[model samples]
Target: MFATRRADLVLILVALIWGSSYLSAKTATAALPVLAVLFARYAISALACGALIGLRRRPRRWTRDEVRSGSVLGITQAVVLAVETYGVAHTSAANAGLIISLTIVLTPLLDRREGRRLPPAFFVAAGLCVLAVGLLTSSTGLHAPRLGDALMLAAAVIRAGHVALVGRLTVGRPVNPLHLTTVQTVVGTALFLPLATPHLPELAHSSATTWYQLVYLALFCSVFAFLAQTWAVQGTSASRASLLLGTEPIWAVAIGISLGGERLTVWTTLGAALMIAGTYWGQAVERAHRTSTPMEESLRSCRTARADGAARRPGAVVASSPARSSSRSRGDTT
Candidate 1:
C-alpha cells in the first residue's frame, strides 16, 4: 500500500513537472531563439543520458530494434516539441497547456491497435472537447483562432499520432527505455545542431535564469519525468497512473496563473473547465471500451498463459517489456 501511494505521488509529481513545462519553455524561448532552446534542451538531455549509461556497472549494448524505434520516435518527438514550443511562445501558458490536453481524446482515435470501434459516447465526449477548443481559441470573441492556439491544436493532433506510434513501435519489444531515450536525445541533438548553429552565441549568452529553465526542461521535464513515470507505473495500474498524470493541465493552469501571472477570462475559464471535464470523461470511456473488448481480453489471457508457461521452462528468460507501458504513454505528451 505504501508502495502504491508512493507511485501515485511520483506520477502526480511527474504530471506537475510536465504541466509547468509550457511556462518553462515559454521563458526559455523568450531569452533565446526557439531553435537554440530546442538544441540546448536536447543536447543537455543527451549528455545526461550518456553520463547515466557510463555510470552503469554493466551497461548493455544497444539493440537493433532499440536504435530503429528510438530514431523514429526521436524525429516525431522533436516535431511535437518544435510545434509545441512555437505555440507556447505565441500563446498564454494556460492556453497552451489546456489546448494541448486535446491529445488525451485525440489519441484514442489515432491508436489502431484495438481495431474495434469506440462507443458513441466516446464521440460525444470528443465533441465536447472540440467545443471547448472552440471556446478556448475564441476567447476574445467569435473569430479566427490566435496563431498560438491553432498551432497548439495542431500540436495536439501530431502528439496523438506520436503517442500511437510509440505504442506501435515499442509494444512487445525488449527495448530498454533508458537506451531508447538516449538514442532519441542524441538524434534530436544531431537534428537540431545545424539549425541552431548560428544562434549558439545567443544561447551561450543567455542569463542564468534562462539557463535554469533550459536545464529544468531537459532534466526534470524530459529525463526525470520519463524515468519516474516508468518506475511509478510499474507499481500501479495503468489506469491509476494515467489518472494521476491527467492532472497535468490543471497544474499548468495553476502555475500559469500563480507564477506566470497569466489570466483566463470568463470564456477561457469556461473553456478550461470544459476541457478538463471532456478529457476525463473521454479517458474513462476509452478505458472502459478497451477493458471490455472481448478480443482484447482473450489476447491478454493467451499472453498471460504463455508467459506463465514459459516461466516454468528449464531455460527461459522473460524480458522486461513495455507492453503495458505503452498504455501509460498515451496520455503523456508534454
Candidate 2:
C-alpha cells in the first residue's frame, strides 16, 4: 500500500517530464521533419534501452498472449505519436499541448462503453466545449492546422483507447508495463521510419541542439516516462492516472511562456481553466463511482454472511438488527 502511493507520485512526475516534451519537440521540428524527429527520438531511446537490457542480461520472456497484447498496446501508442507529431508541427505549441491533454476526457467515454464505470456526463460535454475554445484561440492567419488538428484528434482517440484497453486487459493479470511500453516505442518508430526516409539527408546537416532534443525525448519521455506511466496505471484509477496527467498542459503552458515567450490572452486562459476544472470534476465523480462499485458491496455482503454463520455457531448469535448493516452497504452508486 505504501509503495503504491510512492509509485503514483512517480507517475505524476513522469507526466510532467513527458509534458515538457512539447517544447523540445516544437524546437526540434524547426529544422527536422516531424516524422524524422520522432523517428530519431524513438530509435535513440530503443537502442539505449535495449543496450541497458543487454547489460543486465535479464531474460525477459513472455507468452504469446503477452506479445499479442503488448503489440496492440504498441500500435495504439504509435498511432497517437504519429498524429500528435503531425499536429504539433502544424499548430501552435500551446494548441497541440492542450488538445493532446484533452485525451483525459476521451478516455472515460471509451471505458464506459467497454463496461467500465462511467463518470458524470457533464464533464464529457464540457471537455468538447473546451476543445472548441482551444480551436478558436489557436486558429488564425491561414496557419490553422485543419489537417494537423484532425490528426491530433485522431491521436486523442487512440490514446483514450489505449488507456481503456490497458485497464480492461491487465486486470488480474501479470503484464509488465515496461516491456509493453518498449514494444510500443518500437512499433511507433516502425511506423514513422518509412515516412522519415525522405528526411534522412536533413539529419546530416542538423546541429547539436537537435541531438539534445532527441536525447530528451528518447530517454526521459520515451523510456522512463513510459515505464513510470505503465507502473502507475496498474495501481491507480484510469481517470486518476489521467487526472495526474492532466497537469501536462500546465507544464506545457509554463514552458511556452518561459522559453517560447508565449503569452496567453484572457480567452485562452479562461478556456484552459474551464477545461481543467471540468476534468477535475470528472475525476471526482469517477473516484466516487469506483468506491461504490459492486466489489465493495460484495465485501459488505460477505461480512453479513460471516455474521450469519457466526450465529449458527454454538451459542454465538449476532443481533438481528439490520439498520447499521444496511447503512454500511448503501453507497450512492450501490
Quickly count the clashes in candidate 1. 0
Most lDDT-accurate candidate: 1
lDDT of 1 by residue, 1-334 (tens): 9999999999999999999999999999888999999999999999999999999999998899999999999999999999999999999899999999999999999997868899999999999999899888876676779999999999999999999999999999999999999999999999999999999998888899999999999999999999999999999999999999999999999999999999888888898999999999999999998987987789999999999999999999865468766766775853
* Candidate 2 weakest ten by summed lDDT: 135-144
Clash pairs, model 2 backbone: none
Q: Which ten residues in a row have the lowest lDDT in candidate 1?
A: 325-334
Task: Estimate the Cα RMSD of every predicted model relative to the unseen true structure.
Answer: 11.9, 6.3
Model 2 Cα lDDT, one tens digit per residue, 206-230? 8998988888888888887877787
Model 1 residue pairs with clashes: none
lDDT of 2 at 276: 62
TM, every model: 0.88, 0.78
